[model samples]
Target: MPMNRIQFQPGLSMPEFFEQYGSESRCEAALERARWPEGFRCPCCGTWAHCVLRGANRKMFQCNACRHQTWLIAGTIFQGTKLGLTIWFLAIYLISQAKTGLSALALKRHLGVSYPTAWLIHHKLMHAMAAREERYVLSGQVQVDDAYLGGERGGGKAGRGSENKVPFVAAVSLSDEGHPLRVKLSPVPGFTLKAIAVWASTNLAVGSTVCSDGLACFSAVTEAGCVHQPTVVAGRKPKE
Candidate 1:
């Protein structure tokens, strides 16, 4: 079967955006609303503090019990980041909509932030994605396979021809009841028994029935207590 890829178009004009929220006070109000959607709750005392004005009559609130004064942009991803609110919104919009992943340089130009700052923010967002996705586990019937992702070889005599290739083993689990082999790929140093054993132990459960083409490294699977079914080819016939 053939596969299709997706492309995204640019989105939103600044004037169209500002026409919705054009002023400093308007922007601040929007930030306050987003940061405190449940109204003002005192961070110190955890009570719903009364909304009060800050310097120049700003829209910040003073904590009722502890009198701990704070703004809406406190203690979140936006906290302590000095980039303008408009740029922050644009940065978020661009990254969320991007499919091939955005470069720090791209984000810098798109959001008008320094290169170093953009890199920092981009890495921070990537960390956030991993943290969020780490909660889910792959379960049920799984597919075990090795994909050679070798790269140009390097280091000593081991870095010779076929160096451009690396070994990757993965186990993709069936979705719902259908077996689609949704494995997680990990780079194996080589097709060595030690490498395969470590990868299998980490990626497969003790009860999983793994299928392979009789690779020696996979012998450890049986030793590890899982049933291994090796597909066989003998002479002109097959052995069950």
Candidate 2:
């Protein structure tokens, strides 16, 4: 049996992560570099000339050309955060590195913060991730399927009509070599044609080929100018 290179790729170890971003100064320096890769430029005046001033908690930069002042965290997701840069960076690292996803309760325990603070951090990070993902549209050969979050409750509804289930569409774009490229999992109102059409229009590029299960709503991809290829699964499970 051959090992899958992608699945076995090297990643940052916990010790290495802490070593790189252990102190507040280190985290602040990283943020500074990320925000201003080509050196500091005033957001308001867009000038390279700036002066550093002592802020209440951190250093502030003032543009010499327009006298505009801003903090390093200003206009970023870290803005208005009361937590230290080290805490926020650790939170980011934990959330991003979690393979099975991290809950607010788990984050609170990990970061030693209150439940409300953990919830806020989780919300902000998840929202930022979603906002970033919204910029991309699936193109090329795309494989799509209808799925549901949550499971069927004991005396409630079963199967697709389960009350506990939240309907969503899952799509994966493939590279030219048939390897998966990118994936999008989007929640929808229901499996109606109108809902699928709206989601397709938003998430798929025009003229892309969309391969999906024989769920009739998948035909709505055509409304978004995509070519649809439907495969009937009958009663078999996805893995089968």
Q: TM-score winner among the candidates?
A: 2
Local error of candidate 1 at residue 132 (angstroms) = 3.0
lDDT for every model?
Answer: 0.66, 0.90
- Candidate 2 residues lying further than 4 Å off, grouped into runs, are 1-7, 232-240
- What TM-score does candidate 2 get on C-alpha atoms? 0.88
How much lDDT does candidate 2 score? 0.90
lDDT of 2 by residue, 1-240 (tens): 999998788998889999999998899889889989998999887899999987778868999999999898888888988888888888999999999999999999999999999999999999999999999999999999989999546788788867899998999999999999999999999998999999999999999999987688888999999999876578653321
Q: What is the lDDT of residue 95 in candidate 1?
A: 85
Residue 106, candidate 2: Cα error in Å is: 2.4
Query: What TM-score would every model get versus the actual structure?
Result: 0.55, 0.88
The superposed Cα distance between candidate 2 and the true structure at residue 68, in angstroms, equals 0.7
Angstrom error of the Cα, residue 179, model 2: value is: 1.9
The superposed Cα distance between candidate 2 and the true structure at residue 123, in angstroms, equals: 2.1
Give the number of the best model, judged by lDDT: 2
